[model samples]
Target: MAVALDIVHDTQETYRKVLTSMSRPGTISTVIGDMDNPFPCHYATFLTILTLLDREVYFHVISDGENLSKVITDYTLAQETSIENADFIIVPNGTNEEAVIDAMQKCKVGTLEDPQNSSTWIIEQNMISVTGTITLTGPGIKHTTSLHLDITAELLEMRNRRVQEFPLGIDLIFTDPVSLACIPRTTKVSLDGGVI
Candidate 1:
């Protein structure tokens, strides 16, 4: 096991960086900062899990899982559960459209009265860049922003279907080897080179 990362300070700082990405929607940011990431997934993904998961929650991995569920439990004290009940759904590979959408279909989209009970998805990608054409607008954006994430348009369309209901939706966090970007439920995403 790698013995790096001052849990308290490192986790706090990483949490802030993650929060910044989430709060700002499409803004790209880095996290975990060379803290000896020993997991098979990205440093940002591992560190984000460290920051958000704990004993009270459960997590489930979809593809390229590679025993990460147990590994996460070893670090976060969070247990592994069925996809439908998972608080955090980790997808190390987003190339499988069928499985990705299948999991998303099963994942919780909180009710109108208890919207806070929804799931948070942590998905790994090739990279998170600023040059892509997908437009993002809403809450934290001034006018608009764009990202170049390699996630499938079909998956995004699925997200729109699931989240368009407002309060009841899932939040997305995409990470590369070290960087991450968030797409909160409230953010409007468009791919036709125009606002949705």
Candidate 2:
């Protein structure tokens, strides 16, 4: 028999992992409990969705068919909507960097008074090296920290645009098959070779 996830327990565990990763920013966190088979997207991404999404959330999945979106909405009972309206946006591995930026650009970046409404992105990565390749600083870091990424400069620039105004920026969760890391709006990021 296939292993099953006890919805309440598993979701809570996954939620804790995500929260821990987000709170620590560049640090890696592990997802606890069993995830049977998460297709079209990495298992980590699936579990993150399962943990964070619910009936009140609006989400968008980037793909060619409705299967991925349908499955997510059905399983979570969350509504599926356009990128511009989604509370959570999942960008699968191999998606074009520009497209990811476009979708992110359309997402809600709450106003000064309601910055908490900003969208959160769960982006999948094929690899996350043992040692970080880019540097991260600001809140959550005593000095500086590093983390590996396959993200492009365009995506980095787009992210910067959203964060220009304090308290009104997107939060990102980067996940691979086994690891999860995050970049909250409060962090100041820079790639190797002094690219900020």
Candidate 3:
């Protein structure tokens, strides 16, 4: 069908954008898709989900409403999994700090032998600002880069705890309405100039 072909093309394009952002680490990449939107989730979030989730993987949607569950399953056919077992986790915008904290706390960090089994977070933010207070330093960055999160300090604190140990933490991809950025576990995220 023409509709299916178009979806395939859009998803491929979104995958390229996500890949570029992931490889660059601190830099932002725009996901410009003209795909039809039917869910309550943000446009960027919808695109990210289409690119990352499928029947081969399991995902959990936290900090979002129930409507997203049906939408995600219908489109991606990815299993709706529990937080601890999710290969991918999504946190939609307008979610309270506590819910995000809870999801972060429960997400799997992977095992020693199979670190690739870890969960990846697709988080929707109100906006990924041009300038930020958080400093990032690691594999993909040249020296250090800054990112400002629109969420509360409590959520940041929780995320800080998640990535403390290498090969044993979650990876995060943050999306706004039009753009996305990645923070893989290898990157060190520090608040201000100090490591949290």
Which is the leading candidate under TM-score?
1
Q: Compared to the true structure, candidate 3 yields what TM-score?
A: 0.91
Residue 121 error for model 3, in Å? 0.6
What overall lDDT, based on C-alpha atoms, would model 3 receive against the true structure? Answer: 0.82
Q: Least lDDT summed over 10 consecutive residues: which range in candidate 2?
A: 31-40
Please give, for residues 1-196, the per-residue lDDT of candidate 2 as tens digits: 3456567886787788887878788888876435556566767777888889999999988763527788788788999898888899888888877788888778888888899888999999987653765788888788888888889767887887888798999999998876789999998877774755
Off by over 4 Å in 2: 1-3, 32-38, 64-66
Question: How far out, in Å, is residue 73 in model 2?
Answer: 0.6
Model 3, 57-154: lDDT tens per residue? 99888855657978899988999989999999888887776877998998899888988898999888888865988888888899998887676667
Instruction: Work out candidate 2's RMSD over C-alphas.
Output: 2.1
Query: Whole-model Cα lDDT per candidate?
Result: 0.86, 0.81, 0.82
Candidate scoring better on TM-score of 1 and 2: 1
All-Cα superposition RMSD per candidate? 2.3, 2.1, 2.9
Tell me how far the alpha carbon of residue 11 in candidate 3 is from the true structure, in angstroms, after superposition: 1.4
Candidate 1 has its poorest 10 consecutive residues by lDDT at: 30-39
Q: After superposition, how far is residue 130 of candidate 2 from its true place, in Å?
A: 4.8
- What is the TM-score of each predicted model, taking all chains together? 0.93, 0.91, 0.91
